[model samples]
Target: MKTVAVIDYGMGNLHSASKALEHVADRNTRVVVTCDPETILQADRVVLPGVGAIRDCMAEIRRRGVDDVVRQVVASERPLLGICVGMQVMLNHSEENGGVECLGLMSGNVKFFGRNLKDAAGNKLKVPHMGWSMVDQHQPHALWQGIEKNARFYFVHSYHAHAVDDEVAVGRCDYGVNFDVALAKGTVFAVQFHPEKSAANGLRLLENFLQWSP
Candidate 1:
């Protein structure tokens, strides 16, 4: 049976993510939410999902040896997905929690969306940037197979990643400023939005990840 390891480092939206993956996954596949390095390394795919600060996330990740496993997954060229803060932590550093160093899997920095934010209409935007927004799919990826271009995805983050290379950003969303909401590099693909909470499009993304080979 195919196994998808949703690494639980105590900071991710574990229940929701695992449930969603199981819901979309084939009956032959097994979805496991665990912190065990052996289970993670043995899985066909790995998902790193988070909903909190980068500092605490990194602390738990290293404390449980999940950091090394994540790097190994990347090095092994297996399909790996990062969600929300999970995606943020993939960068070189983050300004959150008074700044924290990240995994450096990708060349980028996470930055706050600024205290006073606004849309193009000049309306003030909230800090968390919560709610649904339209995402621009820049590149044609296998994950974007069924999902329509400019589809809306759920987002609830104050900090966004700034990739050093332009090609790293496969999807983007605009609030007050245009920032990368979805990034892909090598075997890794991470999103700033919560796919589990995103309804149909989100389910489709997770479904694609299950069948994704790289």
Candidate 2:
């Protein structure tokens, strides 16, 4: 049984994310909606949930002094999943809230959408790609287990992650433009969409993460 620690820094959609994982993992998992660094350190698996600014998220984790623990989890080769803003923090830097430093877990920069507007029928699309969108598969990854290629998943985000290495980008989605939808490098896995709010496909994705073996 894997003890998944749903990291709570008072900055993410904690409850819904936990509920989704619970339905899928079926293993020993706890929503550590705590600021205690030890709680995050001791867990076998960690899920970082986010919904706000990257700087704030980093600040909260730093306030709890679990930044090192987070790094440790990344270094330990344990399963670490980030969602939405959680996914943004995985990058080396972000251009949100006047720009801020990030975990640098993955070598890339997070940028706001609509920066590269494509001519779509001579019309510009909106930022914050919201609602249910299809995840474009880049390669085979465990997080995408039981999910069909180009499966629709719920998403609500303005900023997006861009991996320095395309190989790390497991999935992508086209908003006004195409961006990394999901990333998996080493033991770290992250998604830009909210599987908790994505229904059946989302649950299956969560289940795969639960059963995923390094």
Candidate 3:
């Protein structure tokens, strides 16, 4: 049985993520929603979930002194996943909240959507990029296992990740501009979409993560 640590920094919703994972992976998997560094380090996997500003998330992580625990967990090559704003923390930097530094687990920058940007249909779109959107897989990744082409997932992010190397980009979504919707490198995998809120596709995504080897 694999224990997944659902990192609780008091930044975003926790029950939704835990419940979704529990449903997909079954009761054998334990979901630890906590800010405790010790528990996070001891867990077999980590899932960072958030829905607040980047600065606040970072601050909470630092305040709890779990930043190093996150680094250690990823350094050990164990599984680690980040969702939405949680995914943004995996980048090197973010332009939001007056420019703040991120966890640096992945070499990338997070940027916001343009206000005047239009979709491929030439219609003006909203900034937050809310509601259900399509995620196109750009590369083979366990995080996307069993996922079909043009699968729609729930998203509520205003910013997107720009990986320094496009190879790490496993999925992309278009919103005025094409953004790095998902990222994967070694044991570290993250998505800008909220899998817990993405329905069956999201559950399969979590199931895939549970099935991921190394």
Candidate 4:
């Protein structure tokens, strides 16, 4: 049976994420929400999810030794997915919390949306970038399979990733400014939006992830 471990370091909306995964996982698949390193490392796939401040999230991740587990999983090249703050922490650094160092698994930086921001219409936009936004697919990735090109995904973040290499950026979105919304490198796939809250399109993405080979 395939197993997918949802890493629980005390920061993510574990219930929602696990439920969504469970709903889409095949009948033989088992979805586990756990903090145990052994269980996470042994699972067929790993999901890093968070929905809080980067400082607190990183603190818990490191404190619980999940950081090392994440690194190990990435090294294994097993299918891995990161959501929201989960995605941000994959970068080298973040402007949040004045500034916080991250896992540096990927060469990039997390930046704030800034106070002075305006939309294409010259209208002021809010921080956190709440609500749904179009996710423009940049390249053909397994995660994007079955998902429409420019499908709207739920987003609620104040900071976004800026990958050093654009080649890893598989999805892009625009708030007041364009930013990398989804990144794909090797077996890792991360997104700034909440797939569980994205309705049909979101569920399709999760289902695709479950069936994705790499």
Query: How high is the lDDT of residue 147 in model 4?
Result: 84
lDDT digits (tens) for residues 92-200 of candidate 4: 9998999999999889999989998899889999997999999999878988888889999999998988899999899999888889989988889999999999999
Ranking by lDDT: 4, 1, 3, 2
- Root-mean-square deviation (CA) per prediction: 0.8, 1.8, 1.2, 0.7
C-alpha TM-score for every candidate: 0.98, 0.93, 0.96, 0.98
Query: lDDT by residue for model 3 over 1-214, one digit each (tens)?
Result: 7689998878867999988888877667787787777888888889988888898889988897768888899888899988888888888999998899998888999997867878788899888888998888988887777889879999888888899988999899877888898899889889899999999999999998887886
Residue 130's lDDT within candidate 4 is 94
Q: Candidate 4's error at 200, in angstroms? A: 1.0
Say which prediction, candidate 2 or candidate 3, comes out ahead on lDDT: 3
Model 1 lDDT, full chain set: 0.92
Candidate 2 C-alpha lDDT tens digits along 146-197: 7888999999888887899999999998877678979998888899899899
* C-alpha lDDT score of every prediction, in listed order: 0.92, 0.83, 0.87, 0.92
Off by over 4 Å in 2: 27-32, 115-119
True-vs-predicted CA distance for residue 117, candidate 1, Å:
0.9
Q: Count the backbone clashes (under 3 Å) in each candidate.
A: 0, 0, 0, 0
Q: After superposition, how far is residue 176 of candidate 2 from its true place, in Å?
A: 1.4
Candidate with better TM-score, 1 vs 2: 1
